[model samples]
Target: MHNYFILLISLFLLSVSCNSDYTPKPRGYFRIDLPEREYKQTPEKLPYAFEYPVYSVLVNYRQTQPELYWINLVFPKFNATLHLSYKTIDNNLEEYLNDSRNFVYKHTVKADAISETPYLNAEKKVYGILYDIKGDAASNTQFFLTDSTHNFIRGALYFEVYPNKDSLAPVLDFINKDLVHLIETFEWN
Candidate 1:
C-alpha cells in the first residue's frame, strides 16, 4: 500500500510538470489584399505634368507657399497614406534636396526607421528618401522627387496602424510601383 501511494504521488507530480511545460502557438500574421494599378493623368495645372494612381487623390493646397506644395492620397484599407510633394524651385538641385530633407524631418517621429537613397540620375540630380516609420501613431513613407531646381517634389506614404514593415511590405511594394510610375511619368515644362 505504501509503495502504491508513492507511485501515484510521483505520477501526479509528473502529470502536473508535463502540463506546465506547454509550447506556445506561433504568432499569426495579417493577410492584406492590394488593388490593381490604374493611373489617371493630371492636367497641365502647373509647371510640370504627370499621372497618379486612380485610387489615390491629391490634397493639401497652400497659397502662401505655392512653391512648396503637396498631394496626399489616403489608403484606408491598408491603413496607409501617401504624400506627394511638388516644389517650384529657383535654386540648384542639391540645395533643393537639402531643403526637402529638412521638410521631411518635421514629419518624422520617434521610434521609426528612416532610409535615404538618391535615385535614377546624379547629374540630372534626381534624389529621393524612403521613410519606413514603425511604432508611430502616424506611419508613412515620404518620397522626395525633385528636378534639382525650380522643382522639389516629394511623395510620402503612411499608415495609421502599428507600423510593421513586414505587414506593410505588400502595400509599400504596390505604392512604390505607383510612385515609380509617377516619377517616370514626371516631365518638366
Candidate 2:
C-alpha cells in the first residue's frame, strides 16, 4: 500500500511539472573583445601611403606574379585582411574605375544591399568610392582611391570565416572606422 501511494505521488508530481509552459532560449554567440584604436603610417617606398591600425600587420600579397605595391593589412585577431592593389595609371583611368565598380557589384547576389559613398579629398588629390556591402557577402567593404592621372588603388576587406553579418557586425563596425581613417590620411607618394 505504501509503495502504491509513493508511486501515485511521483506520477502526480511529474504531471504537475509537465503542465508548465517552456520555451527554448535562442542561440547565443561568444563575446568579442575589440582593441583600442591606434595607427601607424605606411613606409615611404610604396607609391601610396596611409595610416593603418597598429593592431594590423602589413604584408605583401603572395601571388605568382605579384606587383610591388600589392599588399594586405592583416588583422590577426579578427582573422580578416584588407587587400590593397596599386595600379599605375597609363591613360587607363576609365578601365580601372569600371573594374572597381564591377568588383563591388559582383557581391549583389549575396548582399542585402550595397551603398556607395564618394570620398574626395581635393587637397590630398584623393578621390574614390567606398562600397558598403550589407549581408552574407564574401566582402563587406571595398573602395578605390585614385589620383586620376598616375595612381590608382583598390581595397577590399575580407574575413577568413563564414560570412554572417549578424555575428560580424561589431567587428565590421570597428574596422570601418579604421578604413575611414586610412582613407582620410591617404596621400600619393
Candidate 3:
C-alpha cells in the first residue's frame, strides 16, 4: 500500500511540474508584403515631384518656412507610413546641402541606438542626405532626398513609431526600396 501511494504521489508531482513550466510561444512579427513597382507623376502644383507607389496616399503637412514643406505617403493596407518633408535654403544650393548634412551631424552625436547610411547614391536632379535612423519606433527611417544639382527640391522620410527597432526592421528595409524608387525616378523638369 505504501509503495503504491508513493508511486502515485511521484507521478502527480512530475505531471504538475511539467504543466507549470509549459508555456505557449508568443507570435513574432508578421511578414512584410511589398507590392510590385509602379509609378505616377505628380501634378505641377507640387513644389518638386517624383513617382511613388500608387497605393501610397499623400497628406500634406504644415510648411516650416515659405519654401519648406512636409508630406506623408501612407500605406493603410500595410499599416506603415512614409513622412516626406522639404526645406528650401535662402542661400546657394551648397548651403542647402550642407544644412541637410549638418542636421544628421547633430543627430548622430546626440542620438541613442542610431544606425545611419549617411550617403545615398541619388540620381541627377535628386540628391541630398540619407540616414537609416532607428532610435525610437515612433521615429522610423529618417532620410533626405534632394535634387542634388540644384537644391531646388529636398525631401525627407520619417516613419511613425516609438523606435521598436527590432519589430520595425522589416518595414524599414521594405520602404528603402520605394525611397530608392523616388530618387531614381525623380525629375526636376
Candidate 4:
C-alpha cells in the first residue's frame, strides 16, 4: 500500500507537469493583392496633367484650401490618397517652394530619415523635388513640380489608416512606382 501510494503521487505529479498552458499565436494581417501597373492621362483643359494608375480614381478635392485646382488620387483598396494642389506662379514661386519643403519637414519628428531627389526635364521645362520620408510619418512621399515661371504643383501621398510602416511598406512601394510614372509623363498646359 505504501508503494501504491508513492506511485499514485508520482503519476499525478507527472501528469500535472505534462499539462502546459495554452498560448495563442501572434496576430497577423491580411494579404494585400496588388494589381498590374496601368495608367491613363488626365483629360484636356487642365493647367497641368499627369498619368495616374487605372486602379485609382481622380476626385476633385473639396478642401478649404483656396486653390480651385486641387485634386486627389484615391486608392480604394489601400485607403490612401494622393493630394495634388495646383498654383499658378505669380512671382510667388519662392514662397511656394519653401512651403513644400516645410510640409515635408513637419514629418521629421516621426521620420527615421528624409531624402530628396531633384528631377529636371529641361526639354519639357519640368523641374521638381521628390521627398521620400521613412518611418511612421503620416505621409511617405511628397513632391513638387514647377516650370519656375508659371506653374507650381505639389503632391503628397497619405493613408487613411494608422501610420504603420511595416504594414504599409508594400503599398507605399507600389504607389511610389505610380508616382514616378506620373512625374515622368507630367506636362504643363
Model 4 misplaced stretches (Cα beyond 4 Å): 1-26, 62-65
Off-target runs (Cα >4 Å) in candidate 2 are 1-17, 20-22, 62-65
lDDT for 156 in candidate 4 is 98
Q: List lDDT for all candidates, in order.
A: 0.65, 0.95, 0.62, 0.93
lDDT of 2 by residue, 1-189 (tens): 999999999999999888867889987888999999999999888888999999999987546426778999999999999999999999999999999999999999999999999999999999999999999999999999999999999999999999999899999999999999999999999
Q: What tens-digit string does per-residue lDDT give for candidate 1 at 110-156?
A: 54556665466565455555544443424445556666556677666
Query: Which pairs of residues have clashing backbones in candidate 4?
Result: none
Models sorted by TM-score, best on top: 2, 4, 1, 3
Q: How far is candidate 3 from the true structure (C-alpha RMSD, Å)?
A: 4.3
Ranking by lDDT: 2, 4, 1, 3
lDDT comparing candidate 2 with the true structure: 0.95
TM-score of 3: 0.66
Winner on TM-score between 2 and 3 is 2
Report the number of the highest-lDDT candidate: 2
Write down the worst ten-residue block by lDDT for model 1. 131-140
Tens digits of per-residue lDDT, candidate 3, 103-179, equal 55565543555555544444554554456555543444555655544445444555444556667677667777887
Model 3 segments more than 4 A misplaced: 1-27, 31-33, 61-70, 92-95, 102-125, 135-137, 147-152
